[model samples]
Target chain A: MAEKPKVGCARPTGGLVGQPEARQEQQTSQPTKEVRTMIQVGKPAPDFAAPAYHKGEFTSVKLSDHLGKWVVLCFYPGDFTFV
Target chain B: MSVDSVFVHKMWNDHELSKMVKGGVPFPMLSDGGGKVGTAYGVYDEGAGVENRGRFIIDPDGVIQAFEVLTPPVGRHVSETLRQIQAYQLVRKSKGTEATPSGWKPGKMTLKPGPELVGRVWEVWKTSMEAD
Candidate 1:
């Protein structure tokens, strides 16, 4: 007869094993009253302003500034990564 | 949007992107450091400290008309984005009277949606028309 396997001692410990305390603390610290809104079609886009590199010059870009014309916000992982 | 800084964007454009496209990209390469904009757009990955690939097409009224998000491994096509933009523009210009079928391009046939077209789409539109 094969030896009995260790019961409950061979539990897989791949994910969420050591990080639960930090995660729970983070959740408890934040206010539950705040609502998170998801980005949806047919809804007004959340406006933003940030530094940008355009045509060999450094400038700022604001979403609301391009109100009169159509805007395409193309996002990628990073500058050097394949897009 | 991404977590890369403006300096990195400039270097990448100067060294790499310029060879791919003339004068690099025509639009601004925003440096969304700390993922503020990405968080707002729901593309920020908290564990990775970066944003996933995403695109948003905002109409003239500042409302988001369409959006696409993908993982880092897959690449996006500029031609497809342009085609979608053109299709959206045509529909907007027509004031909801016209609708472009799948894979519709400019100069292709468009369907006039109405009560008459409710069930007769097969009669007026064909898959072959998408090539036109």
Candidate 2:
């Protein structure tokens, strides 16, 4: 069997790691940025690469890798919270 | 499909989420830890600190064919999603010249878009409906 990929999370508050608690708290309290530009239909989707949980393991997923195939990109708020 | 991290996803799958989601989540549950994906897709709610329920279906060419964002209280219907995928697949196979009607299934009649079809769709479609 292949080795499972490591899973890392964003540290609460701000940047990746080791930010001050105040900063973290500020980040946690800050509202999500209101994105002015919305992706439109009949246009290319924004590309992204991120770790995904799949079949009991961590793996990487990229939007570009699926260029020739159909993709269903679902964005839910959170897990296990009436999702 | 959440802003939760992979770690949270793993934990949830190991515990509560798996039970609530019968047969498991068939596709990958991507982690948008920084909400980059959510922001790009225009579903992230900054004030609420959570993403709305957003679904996008991309065609083989990477163009978004259909997308919808719903409030957190309402859950999406999986069967309708499947039907949409089928409909879009049919249209793609037809080279974008055909379109699926409402509640279209694979075997259902499809419409050809043109000036000739204008204002006469019901007459043409009624024949197929009667056949059904």
Using DockQ, give the best candidate's number: 2
**What TM-score against the true fold does each predicted structure earn?**
0.81, 0.79
Candidate 1 lDDT by residue in tens digits, B18-129: 9999989778777776565676677777788888888999999999999998988999887888998899999999999899998689988888988888989889778777
**Per-residue alpha-carbon lDDT of candidate 1 for residues A16-75, written as tens digits (9 for 90 to 100):** 112233245456645211212548999988776666777887666777778879999877
Q: CA lDDT of each candidate?
A: 0.74, 0.73
In order, what DockQ does each candidate have? 0.28, 0.45
The most accurate candidate by lDDT is 1
Per prediction, the TM-score for chain B is 0.93, 0.85
| Model 2 agreement with the true structure over B1-48: per-residue lDDT tens digits | 777877778788878767868756657777776665676678878788
How much is the lDDT of residue A13 in candidate 2?
16
Clashing pairs in 1: A75-B1
Reported per model, the fraction of native interface contacts reproduced equals 0.72, 0.73
Off by over 4 Å in 1: A1-36, B130-132
Model 1 lDDT on a 0 to 1 scale: 0.74
Model 1 reproduced share of reference interface contacts: 0.72
